[model samples]
Target chain A: MSALGSIVPLAFGALRRNRMRSSLTSLGVIIGVGALIVTVSSGEGSKAVLQAQLATLGTNLLIILPGSSTSGGARGGPGSGKPLTHADLLDLVAGVSAARYSAPVDRTTTQVVIDNQNWLTTVYGSTPEFFAIRDWTLARGRFFTSGEADSGAKVCLLGQTVATQLFGNGDPLGQVVRVKIMPCEVVGVLGGKGQSSQGQDQDDLVVMPWVTFKSRMMSQDRVHVGSILISALSPDEVSHAQSQAMGVLRQAHRLSDKELDDFTVRNLADLAATQEQAADTQTGMLRNVAAVSLLVGGIGIMNIMLVSVTERTREIGIRLAIGASENRVLLQFLVEAIVLSAAGGLVGIALGLGGSLALSAINHWPFIVSPGWVLMAFGLSMGIGVVFGFYPARKAARMNPIDALRFE
Target chain B: MSGEPLIDLKAVTRTYLTGAATVHALINVTLTIAPGELVAIMGPSGSGKSTLLNVLGCLDQPTSGSYRFEGREVATLTRAERAALRLSAFGFVFQGFQLIARTDALDNVELPLVYADVPGPERRTRAMDALARVGLVGREHHTPAQLSGGQQQRVAIARALVNRPRLILADEPTGALDTRTSIEVLGLLQSLNHGGITVVVVTHEPDIALYASRRLVVRDGRVISDDRQRAHDAAADLQALPQKAA
Candidate 1:
């Protein structure tokens, strides 16, 4: 027979003779590889979920929030300052060339009651342009007209959660609901938007005209708007739109270059970039952890191979005495170790795929099956076998034939 | 020696150092065996008969000596070269049979040819032929564990002869067998010797030494007595036993 072909059988025979021990040694590799696949796949899946969540935040959209407020020598948080103004919104929309649409927003947390069914939700104050800027679509009825928004009409749209909680499959259109003691006609029901990246429910709010919100509900002043939502001309122009809007607001607020503006410009693109970077960092750490576990598994293979070499000292001697070269004996043991780890790698891949499937199912994330990761993990296991098995194989090959033959 | 010696050792000395003490395993021993000779080396536990066999078979190197095999100075050969020489020219049989366990008899016999890099078909055919010569033709598929001690030794002998080496070095080939099994194993070796292969056996038993054409008694790491005799043919002895199974 060919030299390798013959040696392979001898290695397999030795392993078969110690079946339980060989399997136990391979078990470490299986767990390592399985965990690696699960970690990477789940990481990829979560990243996809994050992207999906970001997409819902609206494409190429920028949000302007009051930067920070200082009261009594104490600086408040970013959104707690100056509360963006209506004139600031008008100047930004007119001055920023890349700005496609802009809308002022104000919100209040209150209970809405209809036919004794009351639900707590955020009542948002915005214009018809708010729906366009936020990319919000109606599942039923229609959004308020610009005239209704300008004329301080008592018309509102219910988010999916509010609609479900107040209407319960009943038609919400034309129904008047008491939103904090002010009865308003439900003009539309917002489509379900699922959850945001921050794990907040995005569809638990009510929308109404900013004029009506100021007149009937809460109004701090005629000049102050809680926030402003602006859409860019396209996703590619988002950064340009952000800088243009920032410069326009700075000029309108009459803040000098040396002074910090009392407003913050937040873009969906920026949030997505930061979230993606964070996910990549987490995925990298997880990959390192998996690699370490695989390393430990390789050490296990090395340990067992050393033990096998010691246990089969006499067999090695016999082979050596029978004219097998030192390299032949070394190759035999090395092949045995590789076979063990490769087999374990295969099993681990199957287990890892199963784990990813479980994770995707439980988390409701996309099932991401990356073939590259599987091949890499399998290749790594094989490499582990070679790297860890070498020392023991060399020891076996370098054994003195006479001493080995004489060994009990 | 009547003809050119197949193995010639000149002033062969093998020494071992253990914890600051020197033990001369084989001390300045010169020995030669010509073609087609059956020689037995007899020695007590530490007389170094096995060491001499190891040096003769090219399994080991002499500490300070010249070992010539087939007129080639083998003492200067590298480890790989000595292994190649052993593969092409000599076969070894140990007391433990040393047939890889869990392997069939045919595969055990094919081990040497594997190192020789023979093609699969020819290795199997030659291994079968060697097994047939050892009279274990029908037991080719039986593992060493399934075979009796005599059968296992026969498999080992088949393995030794599969390469068709010019010399056979057997160290206590029958040491682990019963009297009848030992006789059968010796009979197989004697028949191979009769087929014109040079055979060297190392053993302490006088009864086992009776099958050799020449006997060398080793004492204190040196050959004290060398005697030539008409060898008792083990095959003939086996035939004389009425209950002979092989």
Candidate 2:
């Protein structure tokens, strides 16, 4: 037989003789590799979910909220300062050349009743441009037009949750639902958006004209809009649009150079980028932990191999005395160590993939199988075998045949 | 019996440091062996007969000596070259049989050929042939643990013969066997030696030395006697033993 061909079977036979030791020695490798796979796949899966959630926030969109208001020395959060006004929104749309569409938004939570069914949901006041900027599509009927909005029409769009709660399977397109005291006709049902990245249900709201909302449902003045939503002409112009809108809003608010503007222009892209950076940092920490476990697994293999060499000293003597060269004995033991570790790697990969599959299924995330990482993990395990198995194999090879044969 | 001596050792010595004292294992041993001869080396415990066999088989290097195999100086060989020489020209049979525990008789016999880089099919064929030569045909697949003491020794002898070495070095070949089994093993060695292979056996038992045509008695790290005589026929001795209950 070829030298390596023969040596390999000899190695296998020796390992088979001590099956329990072989398996236990490889357990560390299995757990390390499995952990690596789980961490990486989950990291990728969560990243994908985040990207999808960010996409739902609309492309190249920006939100303009009133700056925080300090009341009794306690600073209230954003959207509590001098409220955005209709005049400021008009000035921003006219002055910001990068802006594609702009709409005013006011939101409040109230109960709506229809027939014998009553459900509580947030109601939003917005112009027709709001639907375009949100990229929202109607699953049924149609959205209210700008003319209807200007005439202060009592037409409204129902979010998926509101539609389902109020109408069940029945058609609600022409049904009139009582919003607080005003009965408003449901013009459309918004498409289901599942959940936001923060796990909040996005499909649970009602939309109507800003004039109708301020005049009827809300106890607020008609002059102030709560917030303004804007979309840039393209993705590349989002930053330019943000800066332009900020400059225009500062001028419209009549703020001096030394004073802070009474508004905040936030880019959705920037928020998504920050969230992505946080996820990446978490994934990097997890990867380092997995790497350390793999290193520990390698040390475990080395320990067992050293013990195996000592236990098989007599076997080494027999081989050497039987005309086997030092290299031959070394190759035999080296092959044994490699086979043990590589076998562990294979089982670990299977375990990691299975664990990833179960976790993704449970969490409703995509099962992303990165072939590159799997191959890298396998190669690294084999490298661990070679690196850790060398010392013991060399020790076996360097033994004097006489002393070795006589080793008790 | 030969053009040049098959083995020639001049003033060979081997020493070791136990802890504080230097001990000589072999002291200025001079010896020669010819082809087609069966030589027995007799000694008490720690008398260095095994050391002599090791030096003859090229398993160890002499401390300060001129030792030659055929015509090549032994000290001139590199470690790998010496290993290659052992693989090609020498076969060792130890008293313990030294058959790998879990391996079958056939694989045990094929080990020397494996180290010699012989290809698979031929190695198996040669191993089977060697097993048959040692009268171990039906027990080819039996592991060392499954075989009797005589059968294990026969398997070791088959391993020694598989490489078709010109010289066979057996250290206390019958040390671990009963008289009947030892006789059977000795009969196998006798037949191989008669096939023109030179054989050297180290033994503490004087009865075992009677089977060789030449005997050298070692004492206190030196050879005390060397004599040539008519060898007892081990095949006849095996035939004379009474049949035991199966």
Candidate 3:
């Protein structure tokens, strides 16, 4: 231990004698480590942002859209087939054991007016179960009741955008708003949900009872819904719920074994997984590039250490003649290399953190600092020092004291 | 003189393979150095004087023969063991005054003790004392470039003395200094010898060899003559030289 203690100062003194060369040699490590930190932390930040956006859609959510229509060998795209009905939603909830909540939805776009202020927005007609499936809660007042939905009462709930557009900062609940020519009373105001994964504003719509919407707003068939939204009991049950819903719908439609599904069920969990995988691939590529740069940096260290060994041959001879052992000489050079690379690693970490903070602020992403990655980067730099330093140290240690002292 | 000889070499031979040519650096040379004796090995270039000094210092092993230092067989020791023996028992001074560049005198003197694993405070005290013994008390902080050639040689001598080794081996210790400075350095070595440290000096100049009590002349890798003579007083010689004009 005392030998190591003495070796450290000797190493430092040698490095200090050639400050410029030492700094330049470690520059490669600095850039490599800095780039690694920036790429990894920013990758994590983007991934977090994407996950939060996905979460805003709902928990264990699934969307079932109507399949394509076929006529005279001509096929229309999805949502052009025989529309799904409220009965199909009811059958799915009853048949699928994993199904937690389900809602039948019909949508239309129209202008809404409160007094003299008018704003164009999308309107959704759904039951009270829609709020549960979407994981939505009211900011004020209460959601419309099932009685109002079944009785086809002209009551509505306002999304934050719609409320802001028509009422400004005024109380929106209990106020009356006109959808086209029909007036409806606002029962509640939904809490804000920001932009979604597809960059669409989720808070730019109004929701009302399905009975009132089919009768008064949209001109579609009264019994058929545009789509069905379902939530599974847990994240792991989403695929099971989807398969169960498909079976239930196929049986309800009386389709034969040879027939294709009349509706398409999409598991949002799968979509999330695919997006997360893409993020991981991007992060992995950047990490590999950073690793290559670090390798180049290690090579640079080795090159400088070799040159330093040659330059200090006479010094080695003097030390050896004064009773320094071969291991002592080897330790001295190895310590110098380690100190150089480790110091570079520290500076790189600081630079990378600063770069990540700046990028997050500029791009409006959450700042995520992964301590494990930082430690690994530091360990990698130190390992490079040891691996690259050994050959030169060994060369110096094996020198003949007579020849070395005579080295011109 | 009653104890075993400090160094014993019996028919030692060292050869070099220089690109398929066998060069005999030392050929069947047998010699012994008693404790506290000042000996000089004199020869022209390529006569194996340096090689003999290297063998005695344990920096090189004989190609074939027994080399015993303080009654211990040096030929059987490993490279690391030889290094440890040198560290504990030998000090070396070179022709170029091989002090590490850019380091102060005190640090150069402290070099050997650093490998000895001496603690910091004690190493400093001993280094300072060694420097003061060489009459370099106020020049402890001067680097090799900052000090004169004579001062640099003194720093090298101080480094050799700092380890308190039993033997000091100097190969042309005054090769780079002037006449008066050479006498000063020889005076220091003679005083060290008087203080019971064995000294072996390798030089081609007969004047330099006159400072030692005994001399061995070498020719063609063989010792031709060995003689015991009264050594000149380096202090008296330094006093007799005329002072330089300021």
Candidate 4:
């Protein structure tokens, strides 16, 4: 057989010579790569799931809130100091070039009594357009018209939790719920929403006409005003929409050049943009961590090869003293190191792909399976073999025949 | 001597640099061995006879002077060039047998061709031929660890002859064998010599040396004696040596 053929048998021979050591070395690589596979795939899948949820916050949606009154109480960064408000929303609707829709939301917390049961819920009051903007669909009955909202109509909608708590499985679309000394007829029941960021069952909240909420229920003069929710005709117009909304709010708040406005605009696009940036950062870190694991695998390869060199010193001497060239000996050992790491890489790739698949299947999450990354990882493994395995191979090649023959 | 000058060493020197000092292993040795010759190198433990054989086998380079193999100056050859020179020109049977412990007899014999890049079928055929020549045709699959010491040395000799090299350098080939095996090993070397392959066997025993047509004695890194006999037959020499000694 050719000298190269000997490499195949010799590599196996070395492994057979010390099966335990070889197994232990490979075990390290397997563990490192396995953990890396799970972590990377998990991180990628989680990011995808979060992005998908964020996308449900439609591009045409905007929220108007009681601009947090921190004008003199501003304690954070410049733009973050402002809160979104209703006047800002009105002005933005009248002024923003990109804003195609806007909504002003007002709400209160009240204890409602029905029969012997008492339930506390948020009462959101807004124009009927709020449904289209917030992407909320009514499960029964109907939302009040804009004129009814302006005229302070006595109509209400029950959130999912309040409906279940009060009505059980019965229909309550036309029933009346007493909202703390005010009786408003239920006009609609909102589809069940799991929960909100503030730990309120979004299903449990009630809704009413904004004018009625302001004129009949709320006694505050300015009414919680600052938060503005806006939606552009398309997702891409968010930047222009943001600037236009800012200009109108600035004009209404009458901000001077030295003064940063006391209001902000938050839209679906903004939330999506920040989330995408975060995803990018997380994905990059995951890749870096995986790279480190592969590097550790590389070190394991080099370390085992060196041990093989020491163990096979006499064999190397015998070959050299016979007729083998130094290069041939070196090549034999080099090929051995590369084959080991490459094999390990192949196994790691399969495991990594399978791990990604399992995660996607069980969690219903999205993952990017880039063949480029797999190929890069495999190539890196081989590179590790060549770069790290060189020193040991050379030492084996350079050994003195007489000394090696006498080695115990 | 057949007047062939198969290997010629002129003013050769080999030096070893240990951690603290330069050690001269061989000093200014000049010698020539003719074709079909059986020569033995004899020396005490520290006499450098092994080092001399190493250089002659082309496993080592001399620090000074010239070594010519088949009239090609060895000192002038590159590492690969010397590998080529060693492949077709010299065979080594190390003192330890150095039979690549895990490899079988046939595989051990095929090592040279492996370097020569010979194809698989040819390598197997040639290796088997060498094993049969060494009377181990049926035992080609036995590893060195499985075989007796004499058999291991015989495998080593088969390895040496597999490439059909011109000169065989055996360094204490029978050192570990029993007396009977040693005699058998020496007889094998004699038979190989009779087949016209030059052989150089290194040992410390006079009996092993007596098997050769010529004996060179070395002391303290220098050759002290060169003795040649008209005919070499261990059976005849054992009988004749007593009279010569008296």
Candidate 1 on A1-408: residue-level lDDT in tens? 367777677777778888899889999999999999999999999999998898888878999899898899999997787677889888987899998888999998999999979999999999998888877988999999999998989999999999999989899999999999899999899988999999899999999999899878874365788899889999999999999999998888889989998898988898899999999999889888888988999999999999889988988888888888988989998999998998889999999999999999999999997889899989999999899999999999999888998888
The C-alpha stretches of model 3 lying farther than 4 A from their native spots are A69-76, A114-117
Proportion of native contacts present in model 4: 0.72
What DockQ, on C-alphas, does every prediction get?
0.74, 0.67, 0.83, 0.59
What are the iRMS values of all candidates?
Answer: 1.2, 1.2, 0.8, 1.6
Once fitted onto the true fold, the runs of candidate 2 whose alpha carbons sit more than 4 angstroms away are A70-74
**TM-score (0 to 1) of chain B, per candidate?**
0.96, 0.97, 0.98, 0.91
Model 4 lDDT on a 0 to 1 scale: 0.77
Best by lDDT: 3
lDDT (tens digit, per residue) of candidate 2 on B1-246:
548999989999999788999889999999989988899999999999988888898888888888999878995576677788888898888988888888899998988988989999999999999999988889999999999988999999999989999999999999999998888888888898999899999999999999999999999889999999899999898778898878
The residue-level lDDT of candidate 4 at A3 comes to 65
Which pairs of residues have clashing backbones in candidate 1?
none
Cα displacement (Å) at residue A218, model 2: 3.9
RMSD versus native structure for model 1: 2.3
lDDT of 3 at B1: 50
Which has the better DockQ: candidate 2, or candidate 4? Answer: 2
lDDT of 1 by residue, B1-246 (tens): 476788888999999899899989889988888899999999999888988888888777899989888899998788888888888988888898988877899988988988889998998999999999888979999999999988888888889899999999999999999887888888888888989999999999999999999999998889899999988878788778778556
TM-score of chain A of 2: 0.95
Candidate 4 residues A163-191, lDDT tens each?
Answer: 88888898887888898778888888887
